[model samples]
Target: MDYLLAILIIVYVALMILVGYIAWKHTSNSEDYLVAGRQSNSYIMALSYGATFISTAAIVGFGGLAGTNGLGILWLVFLNIAVGIFIAFVIFGKPTRKMGQYLNALTFPEFLSKRFNSKFIQYFSGLLIFLTMPIYAASVLIGAARFVETTINIDFNLAILILAIIIGFYVIFGGIKGVMYTDALQGTIMFLGMLILLISIYSMLGGVTHAHELLSSMAPLFPESAKVTGATGWTTFPTTGSPFWWNLVSSIILGVGIGAIAQPQLAVRFMTVKSNKELNRAVLVGGIFIFVTTFTAYVVGALSNVYFYQTTGQIAIQAAGGNVDKIIPTFINSAMPKWFTYIFLLTLLSAAMSTISTQFHVQGSSIAHDVYCAIKNRSSLRITRIGILIAIIIAVVLAYILPGNIVATGTSIFFGICAVAFLPVYLCALFWKRTTKLGAIAGIVSGTVSSLFCLLFTYKKVAAGLGICKFLTGKAVLFSGMPWPYVDPMVIALPIAFIFTIGVSLLTKNSKEEEIAIEKMFKAEEGA
Candidate 1:
């Protein structure tokens, strides 16, 4: 079986290499490397967007959370479709595409910088993404590596290095074109693998009705530690305003769900398409893809509790030995047939690779295009590839150092920070013609500072984990209370960001030159 699995993996890697080689052959200039030459069809655009949006973070990280936290996490699925896909496409996507084209922006930082006419905005945002995005990338790497370690009986460190090197090859050589082409293939595999897993889980437990009933009836078995944190059951919501509820609603659901709109990696996909028509056509595909994948992962995760309890007289968390990051992987390996394990491994590999490839690409562009080129007033595809290599190394190192059960927490931390730091500025750029460069700068600064302060000083999970608050204040968290520790940083910081952006814009004014550029951007929107 190990030999057979090795052959399957080799075939998969070969296919990815073939695709990457084709993309590298087609890629000639910065335009092709950065935005896939802005000629993507709706199918490719949607798949790339969806695949980049959902990753090991969704399948393994959040899926494991669903096992530990119960079905309450399902709210994220609704928000992912409604906000991440629908609102993002219908409201934000068209304008972003149009403005990006008008500005000739190849990257998200470039898009903002060109819109506001600020080199500071470009380089600062780029620097921030370059430095901070590795945490999210590392979390995705950890998710895939954990699965590989478990399924193949390989050393965990080796799995991380292997996945990183393979993904880095295509991202560095083929760029955005390579990333998207492979994304389409991986997204298809994820959708089908998840569909099969969903069907199999249900059928094994006597179909959906019986499976759900069994899970609901086992509410009494909810872990004591989880109950203390306010988890109610496998099929019901947590106690409102409890720590569990706050984590679920604020960090897990709202963090990734609403934060998806402003992600540098995902936002760049809007510019990959030629027109709003492709964005429009992609809405349904993106929506369905998110729904099927997320819904399956969450449901299977919750149902795994039932499976474990029946088989080993243990709840999901206990069955997986208390690591929330391992529940999904553990459940699959323990409950499924060997043949299916190979397929699911491929599914997870596709998920992790698709997301990490886009992340490395975005990080590389942040360095070479937004920071370096903005400073030097010159472009270099060579520098971009070098930047990608650096990004991969940073992510792999973090993957090694970070503790276990960090997948969901790390994902939310990055997503929440992105929301606070970028969402307000991104919205103002897209919608508010009156937004000024000073306002944009102020917004970014305030949001970033406030979020980091909260994470290091007030958010218990992060502050305690980092030991920063303890070292500085002699407390686990600044506020040793119920809601403050539980509430996500985005809850406090995002509103501050929006207020600063709007208030500062009202006080400040754009220069005539900047005004002319803004007018042209709006005109582009009007034409679209």
Candidate 2:
């Protein structure tokens, strides 16, 4: 059985390699490589964006998180549809695509600098993308590798290296078009796999009502060993201050929910589609994809806890003993038929790699288009390829060195940073004329720095409070509470970024040239 699954995995990898090779033929010029010649249709954009957006985080990480949290995790799907697809495209899509067309911006940093006419904004934004995106890429590695390790009982590090090489090869060779095309294929596999898993698990449990009742009655009524904590059985909502509730509302739901709009990898999807009309088309497809994908995964994950607790009398705990990242992988490997587990594992890898490929591509573009271009004083394709190579190398090293649980912790940090760092400046550039170069710079710096500060300080506070924080200051003694004071870093970072953009814009008037540039790009009426 295990051999069958392993063989299926090998086949999936080969198919992906073939896809990458096919995409290779499309990449003669930098424009083709970077933005797909600005010609991706809405169908590709929808599936590709959904694939990149949904990753191991959605399936493994969020699934595990949802297992413990109950149906409350469905809130994220609401946001993905409402904020990520609907509001994002309606509000930000037209302008973002318009700007991308007007300025011929390939990357998010390029969009910022070109709009505001600030070389500094471009350089710093590029630097942030290069520096910060690796954490996200590493998280994808950890999440996908965890699925492999848990499913097949392979060594985690070996799985990480294997998965990294497979994903990195396609991305390094295939670039943007390869990534998006594979992302669409990956999206289909993930959607179908999760859906099938959901049906199978439900059938095994004897139906929805039976499963719900079983899950509900298991926790408190069961033995002490089975006494539900985290995601043992999501029969009911958390008993106040439960890690389940806080994590669902704050970390999973709020963090990824709002974080979607400003994501560099996802943002560039708008540029791929040709017009505002194409973007509108993406909304329906993208919304349905996100809803079904997230709903199936969350339902299966939360209910899998029901299956596990019923069978084993305890939640499937991570051997390293952390949160629920290990839950869905364990559920699949242990509960499902071996053949299905193998099929699902490929789907899981596809989910992670599709997103990982996009992150590397975006990071590469940020370096190639924004930072290296500014530094070298020319947009050289050779320089871009060099930047892409450097980005890949960094990702490879970080994927190897980054500690395991960093996926949940590290990914949150990256999303929070992008939200704080880019969203405000983007809003300002699109809407406000008074946004001077200095104001744009200040907003970005403030948001990026403050977001990092909040994360660092909060992590320290939590570690110290847990009595585990060590090295250097050793957990600020004053933080007596268990988690210290870690809120979503976005809460702090986002406000500071906004203030800098709006406050500074109000204080510092834009030059006539800057104003003219903004108006011409926006094609706005005087009041608008």
Candidate 3:
């Protein structure tokens, strides 16, 4: 089995290299590297968007959360389809595409900077993405590597390096074209593999109804760690207003769901397509893709409890040795056929590769295109490639250092920060013509500072994990309250950002030059 898996992995790597080589041949300039030359079809756009949006973090990290938290985590599935896909495509996609084309913007930060006519906004947003995105990228790396470590019994550190090297090869050379072309292929593999895993799980546990009934009956066995925070059971929602509920709702569901709109990597996908027509066509594909993938992950994660209890008389978390990140991987390896484990490994690889490649690309472009190029007034593909290399190295190091069972928490932290820092400014850029450069800058700064403060001082899980709060305040968290510790930073910071953005914009008038730029940005809308 080891020899077979090795041969299969080699074949997969060779195929990816071929795809990357093809993309490399076509990528002659920065535009092609950054936005796929704005020539992507609906199928490619939708699949790439879906593939990049749903990573191993969703499958392994949040899936394990489902195993621990139960079916309540399924709220994220509805939001993934409704907000992440439908609203993002229908509401945000058209305007972003139009304005990006109008400005000839190659990146998300550039789009906003051009809209607001602020080099500061561009460099600051770029810097934020470059500095913070490694946390999210590292989570994806850990998710894939954890599965590899569990499935093949390989050293965890070695698996992380191997996955990073494979993904870095294509992204550093092939760029967005390579990322998207390969994403389409990988997305399809992920979809099929998940579909099979879903079916096999249901079939293994008798049928859908019986399997669900079994899970529901086993609710009494909810973990004590979760119960101490007011968990009622696995099948039902946590006690309302409980720490568990706040963590589930604010940090996990809303953080990732609403935050998806402002992610630089995913937002950049809107500019890959040519028109609203392609985005419109993509909505259905993207929606179904997200639904199938996320729904399966959550449901299977929840049902794993039943399988584990029946086989080993232990709950999902216990069977996986108390690591939430290991629930799905352990379940798959222990319960499923050996052949399916191979397929699932490919699924995880595709998930991790598609996401991390895009992440590194965005991070690289943030530095080389948005920050460095904006400062130097020049574009260098060599510098962008180098930036990508540096970003990959940082993420790899983070993967090595981050603690266990951190996949879901790390994902939410980055997503929440992006929401607080970028979402207000992003929305204002697209919709509100009255927004000034000062207002946008104010929003970004306030949102970023407040969010970091909350993470370091207020949010118990994060502050305690980092130990910075304890070092300074002599407490796990500065706040000694129920919801305060559990409340996500986005909850506190996003509203503050919106108020600053609107109030400041209303108070300070746009300059003559800024007014002209704003008008140009909204000219299409005004004409319509």
Candidate 3: minimum summed lDDT over ten consecutive residues — where?
A: 519-528
Residue 385 in model 3: lDDT: 95
Q: Candidate 2: which stretches are off by over 4 Å?
A: 1-7, 219-246, 318-323, 459-474, 477-484, 524-528
Mind giving the per-residue lDDT tens digits that candidate 3 earns over 85-193? 9999999998898889888899999998988889999999999999999999999999999999999988999999988888899999999999999999999999999
Model 3: lDDT of residue 33: 94
Residue pairs in clash, model 2:
68-231, 216-235
lDDT of 1: 0.92
- Tens-place lDDT per residue, model 2, 1-528, is 356775787788888898888888888876777788888888889999998988887888777766656667787889888988998888888778877777888788888888888889888989899999988887878888888777777888888778767877777787788898888888888888877887898899999999888777756643333233343445555444544445556666777888888998888888777777888898898888888888888888778767766777665453214456787887887788877887798788888988888887888878887887778877766677667778767876787787544666667667778889988888777777667888898999999888776555554423443343344456543343543353566876788899988888778877888777776766742222
How big is the RMSD of model 2?
Answer: 3.4
By TM-score, rank the candidates, best first: 1, 3, 2
Model 3 whole-model lDDT (C-alpha atoms): 0.92
lDDT score of residue 247 within candidate 1: 88
